[model samples]
Target: MLSNPSFLVAWVFKARYFPHDEILNSKKGSSPSYAWRSIHNSLDELRKGTRWRVGNGRRIHICEDKWLPTPTTYKVTSPPTDFEDFPMVASLIDPDTRWWKANTIRSLFLPFKASTILKISLSYNLPEDRLIWVGNKKGIFTVKSAYYIACNLVDTVEGACMNGLPTMLNLTTRGVNSSGFCPLCDKAIENLPHALLHCDHAKQTWSLWQDCSVNLVSLILDPIDIALNLLEKGTINDLEIFFTEFKGACTSFSLHQNPSATSWRPPPLGFFKINVDGAATEDSGNSSIGVIIHDSHDTAIAALNKVLLAPYTIEVTEALALLHGALFALEMEASYAIFESDALSLIQSINSGVVGGEIGHIL
Candidate 1:
């Protein structure tokens, strides 16, 4: 609703039924109703993540409003006070060329900030300021994103520490009768970090799950920090697997139990495993399909690669690849073969024998 220019204009100028502009733009001289006050309070929270996309920038204030790409409003060591009228962001742009006045911006703002502001490309065709949700990729706001923002704001390390799950060291500090040594590894003190990440048992569990040695010292001090770093550095599938394995490892450790050993086993003596994969180029809309068949001894018996005519959705391409792989396996005179694909949804649909969707026909 806030993104609609017509709605905003009406609220600001039309006062026959509502005084939205007066209430929003100016402080209430007198006490407002409870509902009005509640709305005003919510607006304060909303303002934190909201920023303006520069168009003509006529409506954006130079110093007070959050028009910059950075999180804070524009500031300087010394502010000018002799001007007759406060400057708008439009004043910084060249009227003739419709480009930022580089020299003027450099003199007015900090060097880095001036460069950032100058990088903002403005279109003369779009003359209205656009409200953008800085928290989202598309600059559009949603209640789901707002809920997550609120959760992050409310969550704190202190709150987590006070949730009654005290470590052995914490219990000892509080005069509880307990051994301060780690239960898993008696060599180290049983602090939170030691129990979760540094103990020999914990390290072994992590190594088993991650298929690599665990280095406690290399990890972030806080789990939240590690999670945020992983979110930035890893893919969604990586995070999902990490969380699932970590949870199981922690549960097993708490129970003082070791994880059972498991190894990949090849298909039955007579059967072969056909692994199929699909790739699509997002820019060119081109796709390719590949398949490789391995016998019981895990030796590649046959392989095939075919360039698809046109790009298709990932699910469709994967289904097509699986179909091609099955045909290739039959052509090679394989009586019993297991089709495997990384596309879980396609595999599940094939197993269920219920294929009815966008890519269902391919299956």
Candidate 2:
């Protein structure tokens, strides 16, 4: 820690001016140099996450004018070979002159603090465009590896906070059966490319997929190949959009239509996504409304605290349910609302303000 002049200066001597020896080594039971060594070790050990016994208490006495400049600037006429020469030059200068000189030089290097050192180490690990240089007795080191380690640590922390299940693996293919033909569409199982691109379904999706695949070929291939193909290549962004659309199509094709799926509803727009659901039981003379409001991230922001009173008309309850969600959002400081309903006619009625019919009047 004392290797740098700034740190030494900050600790043992005051700046702008020098400090006297009496003040620098004022503690009763220890030498001034010993006290400085102890402090420096204590600081260094802290960085390494180590603890040590501190013998002397934290009090030191020094001359009153600690930060004053040295009396003689030209005292050190030449660089002397031994450490003993420092004191001779220091004595010729000011009482705390040596400490100030040490610290002033120390500032040119990075600080001894752990955070500062870690930052310096990480800067070297980045790409040349992003890398930072740290100078020491050794040549400069890049901080890329340090940055990767820091990123890994941050990712671990974020992963812990997610509190969700691992993502499901995507199935891209079905292997050939005993007959040596594709299981998905009865085509020959020749090669991976043939299996992916030559199938009947694959043929239907290829024209669009090919246009998108051009963008990502470089990242999938080598830098040399990409450089050679630059003039004829499509951009990476285009492939990304194509992949997203293709994935959505695959998911859509995977779903099986069923009687229970008839009630499935699409999502809403705006800040709050209001879902309106109504139920009625004529035998029990009961009708209830449920309204759920979600944000753009699909998190439940608010719900109608109070359910609608019983025996209400189902259509009226549905309208009230949507209104209840809106009012709840308003109370929660929502500026925009998007109301969704499976009842398309009812939604149209509300938007159109159709006043004559049964559902229209209720909406």
Best lDDT among the predictions, by candidate number = 1
Full-model lDDT, candidate 2:
0.37
lDDT of each: 0.61, 0.37
lDDT of 2 by residue, 1-363 (tens): 212235865654433223442222333333446545565444422222211111110121112111111111101111222333232222221233211233432332223211111111111111111111111111122255334433542453343234221211112223322454556676465333333345565555444334443443223332224334543565554433333332222221111212234453434555566776766554335456677777777687666645443344455555556655666667778777777766555677667654233222123
Q: Give a tens-digit lDDT track for model 1, residues 11-62.
A: 6433432455422354533566665556666766677667667777687877
Residue 56 shift from truth in candidate 2, angstroms: 87
TM-scores, all models, native as reference: 0.37, 0.25
Best by TM-score: 1
Candidate 2's TM-score reads 0.25
Deviation in Å, model 1, residue 254 alpha carbon: 39
